[model samples]
Target chain A: MTRCRFWRLDRHPEGNTDFARFLSLQEEDCAPLADGEVRIATEWLSMDAGTRMWMSPRTDGYQPPLPLGSKMVGLVLGRVIESADAGYPVGALVRGFGQWADVATVVPALTGLEVVDETVADPRQHFGALGMNAWTAYVGVKEVASVKPGEWLVVSAAAGATGSLACQVGRNLGAKVVGIAGGADKCRYLTEEVGVDMAIDYRNEDVDARLAEVPGGVNAFFDNVGGPILDAVLGNMAHYGRVAVCGMVAGYDTDAPMPGPAKFDQVLMRRLRIEGFFIPDFLHRGAEFMPQLREWLDAGKLAVRFDETAGLENVLTAYERMLTGKNIGKVVVKL
Target chain B: MTRCRFWRLDRHPEGNTDFARFLSLQEEDCAPLADGEVRIATEWLSMDAGTRMWMSPRTDGYQPPLPLGSKMVGLVLGRVIESADAGYPVGALVRGFGQWADVATVVPALTGLEVVDETVADPRQHFGALGMNAWTAYVGVKEVASVKPGEWLVVSAAAGATGSLACQVGRNLGAKVVGIAGGADKCRYLTEEVGVDMAIDYRNEDVDARLAEVPGGVNAFFDNVGGPILDAVLGNMAHYGRVAVCGMVAGYDTDAPMPGPAKFDQVLMRRLRIEGFFIPDFLHRGAEFMPQLREWLDAGKLAVRFDETAGLENVLTAYERMLTGKNIGKVVVKL
Candidate 1:
């Protein structure tokens, strides 16, 4: 038996997560791996805004709410130390949806696990730029929004994981990208580093006024932060614009009912197309995504920055920071 | 010179349109027809909710706000009285965006004028079931929403022109249709006359509670009336649902800022797609729309109910009633 430490959901959260009250850290013994099973030592845990949604009492979301008294759900990068499964050889790195734990036993048939090649690219890149974030931005900009060259595309939360990638991808697709971020630093990162044509410091500047100054108006909006910003963007959208509804991190922490876009009339008046998507639905098109993303990464056309915290003990702080928009890029915790 | 009576935009309205203040009845001398022009005597004028949007001060809508002192723009069915053009012979019926006037001179090259064949279908039917209303519903449901058989489709304002047609069309596509309308009469009309599976009297019953009673949930939403009802429907939508935003008659009369759906977060959580569409953008597909609509009309699979008032002088009352949801089916003025 191997000793394992993991976080368990003690209760559903209200408003902002009270991590200590809703989650419990427990140490347990893992049974020896059966045939076709591998025991992995968790190395890094990816904390995303989506994780917060699972803790909410709302059951109508795409993914079901987390069950009370179960291991808190998350995606993790791990190394296979003990493997009875020939497919997952010992010393190989793997990635999958495993609980936030120091170690986990993965059954090949029962769960989805992908072997990672560290030599090709860093494993962390796979978790951020080269993985879910890139795939989401790719499918959203190329497939859903169908962004065209010279078209003005606006992206909210431009400094966040998916938004950052979407900004770069929109530029690669020949779109004139306008980014919206909270602070001066994130806004600067968006324009100077991420290569967006312009960045609005939403905390300082008026989003609607700034957007209205754009010459031809916003042809597409890639929304990550929903709320007043989303409403403001809706008001500035050009005729027949498209909106790719990615994430609403702004509303994830609120216990009170979040209000819809007040300017939703723009959706009707401008003939906008707003589509909400889940990345898992487009994983089948990974062949179409990974290659282009890899090429861009190699060409230096794309770059990823991580706001990483060391140790699983600090996961709560990292998560709280992410929910409060304190992190600049992808928020991750090393176990 | 022929004396012609027309309605002109006197000024932009503040709230519920003051017909006498914002609009003026003017007696004008009709100019003689040119070599390629035809003069038509207006018979039936289509008074739609879209006409009210043109009177608002908002300049960023799909159609521009009506310029002050111009004729109130509307679709009209008329008979050609004088013709210098061979294509538009005398006594032929025509339909186009002409003034709210008794007579209009149409130049075939400059303006779109469709010559209606009364023998094939009544000219008034051309304005209702076989005209813009049917086309709007067809494009929104078939092309935009892409509703499938057995899918539960909820249509707002099911007693209105486009909504009524959308209900019938959803049934034709094998969908279980639920309609939201005001008053018990309109609700009864939706279920019995329009062949909807269920009808929710929004005036009497709670839309969200009734929609929750639906077994499979709402697969698609054909939204014509946007307001609290639209927000309620958002909460009841099924996963991967589609919403076709056709109109917002509820907000058409308001000068005050309108609040959007309070439950719009459902748009992201449920992976829903909301598309706003204009009928004119799909007008090129008339070859695809007209034949099918004509067939439905011929087979009695579709029927049109017109809330018509006599005389152009009463156009103001009819327009007000249409905007306020006082009329059932298509509201028109028989000039």
Candidate 2:
């Protein structure tokens, strides 16, 4: 038997997640792997804002709420230590929904475990740029927004995981990408590192004013942070602009309902199309997208930024940091 | 030469149109028709909520603002009194954008005038069911929403010109239709006359609660009235639902900015797609839709309700009545 540590959801959060009170670290004994099962030693745990939404009492969403006393749900990249499954051999690196645990027993068929390619230069890239974030941005910009060349593409929360990748994707697709981020450093990183044409620091400048100055106005908006920022963007959208709503991170933690976009009339007046998407819906398109992403990665046309914390013990701290927009890119905990 | 009476925009309205103040009855002298020009004596003038939007001072939108001193823009069905154009012979009944006028000279090529079929029982039906209203409904329901059979469709302002047609179109496409109208009379007309599966009188019942009672929730929403009603429908939308935003009449008269949909998060949570479209954008599709519309009209599958006032001199009164929701169905001024 092996002792494994995992975080359990002790209670539903009222507003913002109170990690200490709502979640508890629990130790559980794991028996030897059964037939068609593999034991994984978790290495990297991805922290997502969506995790907070799952902690709410609401059951009427795209995903079901996490029941009380259950292991907190999350995605993990791990290496198989023991395997009774032929498909997942011992020492094979794999990625799947293993929750927040140091060790997890998974049946590849049940968990839909994916074996990571060993030849990839950086495995962490798979957790972000080559994984969910990049895939979401690709689907949004290419599939939903259908971003055209010379079109002004605006990305909200541009320093975050999905938004950062979306900026690069927009530029790669020949769009004039503008990034909206918090603080001076992140804005600088957006323009310099992410290679966006312009970066607006929401804390310092008026988003609507800056967007108004753009020559033709925003033709496509890839929104991650919803609320007032969405309204501001709506006011500046060009005629027939498209908005791909990837996430509404700004309102995720609020107990009170977030206000809707004030400039929503622009939706009718400008003939805009606002569509929301889930990453899981387009996972099948990965085969068509991954090769192009890999080529871009190999050719040095695309770059990824990782904001990693050293240990699983500090996952809560990292999560809080991510929620507050303290981290510049993908927030992950190394176990 | 013939004398023509028309409404000219004296100034832009501040809030709800003060028609008496901003619009003035002006008499103009019509010269003899030049080559390819036809002089039309107006019959029924269409009063649309969209006319108010053009009255605003804002120049940025899908259509340009109505300039001061120009005739107030509107659609009119008229008979050709005299014609220099061979295509539009004298005594032909035509429909085109002739502003609010009793007589006007138009070059058919420039104005895109269409000669109305003489076999039509009621010429008013052309304005309501077989013309722009029906076309708008068809494009929104079939082309934009792509409303599938057995799907639940919720239409706002469901007793209005476009909304009534949209409900019938949804039912015609084998969809389970629900209508949200303002009053009990309109609600009755929706269920009894329009043949909607359900009708909710927003003046009395809670739209969101009633929608929640529906088995699977709204799969497609055809919105003409936008504001609180749009928010309510958004809250009860099924996963991957589509909203075709044809108009936002609720906010069309407001002085201050109208509040957006409060339940907008459902757009992301339910993965909703909200797209705005104009009739002109899909005018090319009229060839595909008009034949089917004509068949439905002839087959008694579709019925039109005209809320008309006598004489073009009372056009402002009818326009005001349409704007205030006092008139149900298609509001037209009969000359």
Candidate 3:
């Protein structure tokens, strides 16, 4: 039996910052893989805001609250070392929802475990450019927001994984992009490295005032944070604007829901459309979305900056960074 | 010269109830029709919640605030007594946006003036089954909400003009309809007269608790009132549900915007779609909508209860009644 170390959720978290108090790192012997299950030798784990909601006791999330005393669940990218499933064979690179452990044992069908291409220059791209975040950015910006050429597209949490890719996706689709981020560094990265038309430092700048200056108002919004920033964007939306609600990281940490945006009346006032979508709901359409995502990635139009942290012991640190907007891009922990 | 009695805006009202303090009944001699203008001897004036929004000094509504001291504008159903436009000849019955006056002067193109079919059994049917409210109900139910057969549909303010029509439209399309309104009488009117499968008295019962009893959750929502009622409906919406925001009458009364529904997060949690639309944008498709509405009316499937109030001098009393939900169904003033 292989010895494995995993973070167990000891209690439901109150907010994003208190994860250490609710979770504990423990070592255990790996149990034999059940039939139709695959065991992955975890090499890296993607820290996402969604997992933070599952960690709370909130009953209103897309997925039910994670039961206490269970292994913390998150996106895992690694190789399948042992398998009882025919589809996920041994020696295959895989990515899906798996435990935060050195060896993650998961039911292939239940975990959405599937083999990933090994031909990509960087295996980490599985969690970056060609991953769930990219799929979300692609679907949200292209299909949901219905962005057209020369239209103004605004992205919130623009320095993060999905938002960064969404910015590039909007740009590649010929939309003029305005990225909203927390600090000068992320703002600079958005305008310089990410090639956005403009970057608003939300922490220092008045988001509402800046967005008000947008010519013809913002026609499309790809939103991750759904609190004050959402209100600011809603107030500045053009007539018949579309808002693709990708995430509400602002309310993920707490059990209580964040209050609805103050300017939500703008939805009716401007005759707008607001739609909420997640990547998992569109999993079946990954094949349809992949060709375009890959082409942009290969042509250097789509890029993701990795805010990497080493060791599973520091997963909490990396997660807090992502949740609190401390990191500039995708936050990942190397096992 | 013909004498004209019209309501003029003296000041913006603070709430739906205070119209008496802001508007005054005044008389003036009607001027000769200008080029492309048509004059209508107003027979009936449609009382609408939309005009209530225009009465506030709020600048955030779809249309600009109605300028103080201008004639109060409303829908007029009458005969064209004078015309400079060839399209609308004298003696033709017409309906369009015109002044709340005995003799309404209008530019045919600007006010959406169009001659009506005179053969219908009741001219009031033009303000009932074939009116703007019916068109709004049809578009909101069939196109915006996208209610499928056998699905549960919830309509707020179900005793109001548009809401009642929406409930019938949903039923006509084979959807299971649930109507929500404020009083027991309104609830009775919904279930008995409107033929809704279920009726919840929002003032007497817990809307959220009652909606929770829906077998498969509410699949579509035609919301006229947007406050706690909206929040209740949001909490009970099925996965991928659609909300057609026809009006936000709860906020229409005040200059300050109503806060968004407390369960706004449900949009993301349930993967819902919320869209806002008004009748004016769809005026061009009135011809396309008329045949089906006429069929329903002719077949006895469509009906509107007129809460008739006599005299243009009492227009405020009638308008206030409609705005405050004191009257059921279509409220109109006889000139």
Best model per DockQ: 3
Q: Residues B195-267, candidate 3: write the lDDT tens digits.
A: 9999999889999999999997999999998999999899999999999999998888677878978998998
DockQ of 1: 0.73
By lDDT, highest first, what's the ranking? 3, 2, 1
For TM-score, candidate 1 versus 3, the one ahead is 3
lDDT (C-alpha) at residue B193 in model 1: 85
Of 1 and 2, the candidate ahead on DockQ is 1
Winner on lDDT (1 vs 3): 3
Over A171-290, each residue of candidate 1 has an lDDT whose tens digit, in order, gives 999999999999999998997889999999999999999999888788998998888899888888888889999888778876455787888888888888999987666655565677
Worst 10 residues of 2 chain B by lDDT: B279-288
**Which digits, one per residue and each the tens of the lDDT, describe model 1 over residues B99-190?**
78898777765556778767765667877878888999988888788899999999999999889999999988899999999999999888
Per-residue alpha-carbon lDDT of candidate 2 for residues B69-105, written as tens digits (9 for 90 to 100): 9988788898999998888888999987777988867
Per-model root-mean-square deviation over C-alphas: 2.4, 2.4, 1.2
Candidate 1 residue-wise lDDT at B249: 79
Worst 10 residues of 3 chain B by lDDT: B51-60
- Candidate 1 CAPRI assessment class: medium
DockQ of model 2, rounded to 2 decimals: 0.69
Better of 2 and 3 by DockQ: 3
Which residue pairs in candidate 3 collide?
Answer: none
The true-versus-predicted C-alpha distance at residue A105 of model 1, in Å, is 3.8
